[model samples]
Target: MSLPHTPLERVTSIKRKLIILIGVAVGATIAVFYVGVKLGAWPGIAGALGGVVALAAVWFLARGLTRPVREMAHAANLITRGDFDVRVSAESRRDEIGALARAFNRMAVELGETDRLRRDLVANVSHELRTPITALQVHLENLVDGVESADPETLQTMLDQTIRLGRLVEQLLDLSRLEAGVVPLDIRSFDVETMLQGAVRESRLVRPGGAIAVRVDPTGLQGVGDAERLHQVIANLVENALRYSPTQSAVEVRATKTHEAVVLEVLDEGPGIAPGDAERVFERFYRSDAARSSEMGGAGLGLAIARWVVDLHGGSIRAEARDPQGCRIVVELPTAIGAA
Candidate 1:
């Protein structure tokens, strides 16, 4: 992408300035001809010829300058009416108009992407919401009709569906809050290892027999950030690891303190994310073909929320294929000052 033209370039662009200049010149020529006719007949004929020539020049210049803008204006109207595919043929020009064309193309691309994501979000959310709600309705109906109810198994299933619905709603709301930037980060310094241990414990609760190994470079891997939010980030990563990994496969948590930052990695022995999906895995409502189990996965919001929290603390999070097997999620955060 070429840099946008500077103010100096805009002023100096002869082609861009000529469109206005042509209109003014045509008007001046006509005014001179009108005055010359009032003065004398010969002067009027000569002035009229000059005015006619100027008018022709203006017509050509107007077509060249205004055609692209007319096309763009029509396309913009279509876009406003919910058409995202309309494109203008102005990118080939090497002037201010070309810059406008490129910007319009970029806007169209972004609007198209946003519209697609919006549709996907609505579909996914509806599907996710309906599943548990349908299950609950069925269970309630059965109980009301006296066809079922005293059994512990049936009750438990309904309870599980309710829990699932609640979890999904909570995650969606949290995601909204984070994205809106209303959730403030209470920054502070604390022991990151302690938070890691807590997250590992939570993951173990999710999968009782799964192993979560922690490997820290230094004794106490201290970090500085909102500890509670960081814990949520860690737990989400660990839960994702457990959900995809085998029953007894080990998930590793590695931590190290660098010169100016604290780095943590969560490694899972599951089918790793595909290269194409690595960048998009953190997108809300996104599911990949590389996913271990499409039906069994969470509402596809965990990684997105985790990323938001990490970013809140001036941190970066990324995922990659683990060596030889599995997937790795790395989180890097800036360390607070003067902490040993």
Candidate 2:
């Protein structure tokens, strides 16, 4: 049943309001008892009737104070059943219950966001796997039905698809390990120039004709971190740049040392990321240009993995708009005090 509205509802502090209601109920009871005795009623009967009057007054006056707690209890039960959308209407009050209600709402919002990410993860992984699996299945079916010959060229194409599927699976496992904090970092000083050269060579092999340029300030700049993981970071950055960069346009990779940090950059001359998508581009499977990203066979996990690795090294990474056009991704890692 709904609480009967009382004048004490306007009070902000529940403690003070409850005290006042109790005082009023006691005063009403005493007044009623005195009136009955003045009318020549028996003292015992008058007191009993007065006690009933006090109980009724309390029931009417204090019900509103407990209503919010009841609402929260109901909301909590709903939340336990996976209903993150449930909300209590107690925040409109200026009481302790109101603060609790606001906190509950914030928790609900975070839970909803986490649930959304989980759902998206499953859906995106399925979609990414389906594309390559579908291609392989169609080719194999054609060959089996004698509709097409399994020539050297056809076999190579199927092999490439198989390799792509393997790469995706491997990356997924790598990312899982990275996220689980199980991948041990082998931190040490390494030559930034050598790392860039190796990454560039790999990129060249992947796209033979794409132009990739690298520059390390001071000619032999060094970084203090896990060399292998750092190499993975640069390789992913370079690969992303190569995939999006226009033909004949060079992807620039630069490494420079500051007073306390070693900064790495990759600039690509592709259609730049939208301003609204700058931060979100690092979220797993979140592609700003979904159609183009799918066409380029990007699973959108590279930057997310890079961010995790950089975060593990106590470093920071961000995206920026390059001059005139294009995008620049900057990764900054702290340098050891005395390391080169």
Query: Which digits, one per residue and each the tens of the lDDT, describe model 2 over residues 222-306?
Result: 8888888888888888887877767777799999989989999999888777788899989887777743545773778888999
TM match of model 1 to true structure = 0.81
TM-score of each prediction = 0.81, 0.84
- Each prediction's RMSD over C-alphas, in Å, is 5.3, 3.7
Candidate 2 structure, TM-score to reference? 0.84
RMSD of 2: 3.7
Q: What lDDT does candidate 2 reach at residue 254? A: 94
**Off by more than 4 A, model 1:** 1-41, 270-277, 287-294, 322-324, 336-340
lDDT of each: 0.82, 0.84
